[model samples]
Target chain A: MPPVVKIEEIHKIYDSGEVPVHAVRGVTLEIERGDFVALMGASGSGKSTLMNLLGCLDRPTRGRYLLDGIDVSQLDRNALADIRNQKLGFVFQGFNLLARTTALENVELPMLYGARKFTTKQIRERAMHCLDIVGLSQRFDHFPSQLSGGQQQRVAIARALVNEPQVLLADEPTGNLDTRTSAEVMGVFQKLNDEGITIVMVTHELDIAHFCKRNLILRDGVMVRDEAVSNRSFAATELEKLSSAEAAAKLTGAKT
Target chain B: MRFGSIIKVALRALMRNTMRSILTALGIIIGVGAVIAMVSIGNGAKAQVEAQVASLGQNVITVFSGSMSSGGMRGGWGSSPSLTIEDAEAIEREVTGIVGVSPEVRDRNQVLANGLNWNTSVNGESPDYPDIRSWKIASGAMFSDQDVRSVAKVCVIGKTVADQLFANGDPVGQTLRIRNIPFKVLGVLDSKGFNLFGQDQDDAVLVPYTSHMKRLSRRSYISSILIQAASADVIDKVQKDITEVLTQRRKGREPDFTVRNQVELAQTATATTQTMTLLLAAIASVSLLVGGIGIMNIMLVSVTERTREIGIRLAIGAHGSDVLMQFLIEATILSSLGGVIGILLGIGSSQLVSHLNGWPVLVSTASVVIAFVFSAAVGMFFGFYPARKAAQLDPIDALRYE
Candidate 1:
């Protein structure tokens, strides 16, 4: 079977200001279906730009991009939008759930703009199922403001998955969460990956990269490292270790 | 995207900023309201004038003594007394399609009756006066043709004259002294509120033109001749015939008379109100235009404020056209809703004006429909730029907008 995403000699340049910026130099990559990959880079390292190209949010300056076996690199803006709606999902760092909207409605938003028509009942059922997958079915009616940061991120993740897209692209999905909540969110991702959902996440944190099966690191607009994670961290095990360590510290303080 | 969803999304967005939306819609509301109110008041004035003109009786024509001419030194209508009693008699004999003819001789004098006195107009008319003027006598009866030929001392007193001079008793069968001449009140006229010229039509007593010309004022000629045609279809023919007969009677002398029909009277009376209505509507539409600008201003602000929301939608696979549709729907809903409320407000205010200040007011469905359509069009027209601006936004820059 062909890879879900295959990019050949992809390049992205920005001529916005006086000095031209080659945000992403020629980089070729491929990701098989159900693979969980992490993209790691420092600020200004063009990770975001590369992620945008992969998500079809922005087109590459020069390259061939095949998403889910369709060549999307030559498509117009509207066609790209259709590709995004039908095959690619996005979870942003800021948990970009529409404010004042309930979690279920936020999840249902992608379907509202999708190519296929859905009845209201079908949309509601599908959104509820996605929220259930993210452990947020109980908070379906809760607004983003009412949820904790981790819950809001979960809602955003549910929104990303509602379309059943082939690729889930998350940009710093846990950037604003605490360590325990970050681990919890990663656990959700790991569980989904175990069920054969492909994910590509971008993050600067080394520990966050360890949660994925593979890591690709960029520096100065070039890929510096591409390797399978040798000492991968499991979020479920890390969360367990964290709770035990907290229990031990509490016991020691009580004895003192 | 489905139209229903687009509308739902727009409504939700508007609800998010309820106060600002209401304020923006207020501009359209007031604009439409002003348009409706001004048109209604103008229409009401026209209706009042038409009703008053109709009171002069249907298919009626008037021959005044003075002609309207630009070349000669101007003397307004009724300035010269050239209509003699013979001229009225000649019109009655020669003119066809005429139902009634009355030689009107008007004078203002102190009338005394039932030990009371009042200053009122005394009109000299034939027995056909009541029928010609469409006036109904409340009691007794109009004097007979024999009374007119015999120069009877009988008269008909109007309601206002009756009220002022015979407050305690029936005016009919009583003595009404006009200019120190005692005349019997044959009947009392039903009240007619006022005429187009604001003259009190009911403050008058009617006597035979013979008595008015030969005894009351001692004048050789009548003031004007009021003629009623058989039907509306022949009023012009009747008027032309009267002019021809009168001109021939003058034996080739430059005719000193002017002819007018009810239609001309109505047109002349309503022309000012029509112009005023148009001017007011123009001014009101300017405000509606201002209101449209207000909508554009607010929509631009909303587009700026919701840039982040737009970015998120775009990233989630919303087409630029979707964003445009959503914003356009939002503006249209705001304006059309304002238009509906404004129509109600306009009607209510016009009714209040009519009730409180005693001014006439008419609310027409055509105006309401026009106001609604205009407001909606205004929304579409003014909303285009901002909606396009939102639709053309770069998703990357918009998503990153702080």
Candidate 2:
């Protein structure tokens, strides 16, 4: 079977100013089915730009991108939007769940804009199922304001997954969460990956990179490293280790 | 996207800011309300004028003396008493489509009857006078043609004259003294309220033109002539025939009399109110335009305020057209909702005015429909620029918008 995402010599140039800014320079990569990739780079390193290209939020100035074996690099804005709707899901760092909307309604939004028509019943059931997948079934009716930071991120994840997209694109999905909540969110991603859903994440944290199957680093808009994570960290084990460390600290403090 | 979902999304967005939405629609409400109210008031005035014109009698024409240029000194209508009884008789003889003709001589004087005195107009007319003027006889009968020929001292007392002179008894078979000439009352005319000129129609007495000419007015020429056409369709033909016969009788006398039909009188009376209606509607429409501008201003502000929301939608696979449609639908919903409220408000307030002020107000369905459609159109027209701005936003920049 073909890889879910394939790109050859993808380049994005920003000519909005007198100075031409090459944001992404001749980056060639592939993401296989069920692969979890952490696209890592510092600020201004073009990781966000590459992520935008991969998610079809933008088109490359020069490249051939085949998402699910269909060439979408040259598609117009509306066609690209359709491809993004059907083939990709996105989770943002800010937990971009629409304000004042319930978790279930946020999850159901993408389906409302989908090319295929869905009955209200189907939409509700499907949104519920996605919330269930993210362990937020009980919190479906809770609005973003009502949810905690981690719960809100989870709701956003459920929204991303509701369309059943082949590749989930998460841009700093846990950047706002604390260490423990980050692990919990990573655990959810790991669980989704285990269920054979591909995910591509952008994060600057080294420890966060270890949660993925592979890590790619970019420097000056050029790919610098592409390597398997030899010491992969399961969020489940990390969370367990965190709780026990807390328990040991509590015990030590009691003895003192 | 499904149209139903788009509407749902738009309604939800509007409901999210209910206070702002209501404020935004208030402009349209006032605009449409003013339009409806102004038009209704104008229409009401026009209807009242038309009703008064109808009171002048149906299919009737009048020929007033002296709208002529003699020796280069032009005189307005009724300036000089030039129409004579012979002219009225000639029209009655020569005009084919005329039903009746009456020579009229009008005078105002104080009279005594039943040991009481009152000042009122005394009109001298033929036996066809009551029929020509559509005036009804409340009691007793009109004086016969023999009474007119013999210059009988018989008259029909109006209700106002009867009530004033014969306070305790019927005026019929009683006497009313006009210019100190005692004339026996033959009948009493039914009360007709004030005319368009605010003149009380029932505050007068009718006597034969012969008696009025010989005893009261004492002139050879009559003041005017009233002629009733056989039917409405023949009014123009009958008028033309009268003009021809009178012109021939004058024999190059510069056509001293002016002929007028009821239709012309009605048109002249209604023209001012029609202009007022149009002017009021025009002014009202300017306010509506201002209201449209208000909508555009709010929509522009809304687009800016909800930039992040639009970004989220676009990033989540919403097409630009979808965003445009959503905003457009939101504007339409706001304006059309305002339109409905304004229509109800207009009707309510007009009815209130009519009830409170005793002013006639006609609320036409056409005006309501036009106001509604205009409001909706205002929404669409003013909403386009802001909606287009939202639609043209780049998803990448939009998603990144703080």
* Candidate RMSDs in order: 3.3, 2.5
TM-scores of the candidates are: 0.90, 0.93
Tens digits of per-residue lDDT, candidate 1, A150-244, equal 99999999999988999999999999998999999999999999999999999999999999999999987888899999999999899999999
Local error of candidate 2 at residue B312 (angstroms):
1.0
Tens digit per residue, CA lDDT, model 1, B1-402: 899989988899889889998899899999999999999999999898889989988888999897445568777887677899899999999988999999999989998877788998888999889999999999999988888888889899888898898888787888978878999998998999898878889999999989888889989888799999999999889999999999999899988988999999889999999999999999999988998999999999999988999999999999999999999999999999989998899999999999999999989889999999999999999999999999999888888988
- Supply the DockQ value of model 2: 0.72
Question: Model 1: runs farther than 4 Å from truth?
Answer: B36-42, B67-76, B79-81, B84-99, B108-119, B145-152, B175-182, B214-220, B229-238, B248-251, B277-287, B337-356
Give a tens-digit lDDT track for model 2, residues A1-256.
9999999999999999999999999999999999999999999999999999999999999999999999999999899889988899999999988888899999999998968888999999999999999999998888899999999999999989988999999999989999999999999999999999999999999999999999999998899999999999999899999999999999999999
Interface RMSD of 2: 1.0
Give the CAPRI rating of model 1: medium
Q: Lowest-scoring 10 consecutive residues by lDDT in candidate 2 chain B?
A: B66-75
The true-versus-predicted C-alpha distance at residue A193 of model 1, in Å, is: 2.2
Report the TM-score of candidate 1, chain B only: 0.88
Q: What would the per-residue lDDT of candidate 2 be over residues B1-402, giving only the tens digit for each residue?
A: 788878888898889889988988988898899899989988999999998988878889999998656799977888687888889989988889888899999989897987789999989999998888788899999998999899999999888888888999888888878778889998998888899899999899889999999999898889899999999999999999999999999899788888999998899999999999999999988888888888899899989888888888988899999999988988988898989998888888889999999889999999999999999999999998999999999988887777
What are the Cα lDDT values of the candidates? 0.92, 0.91
Off by over 4 Å in 2: B67-76, B79-82, B93-100, B144-151, B179-181, B230-234, B351-357
The model with the greatest DockQ is: 2
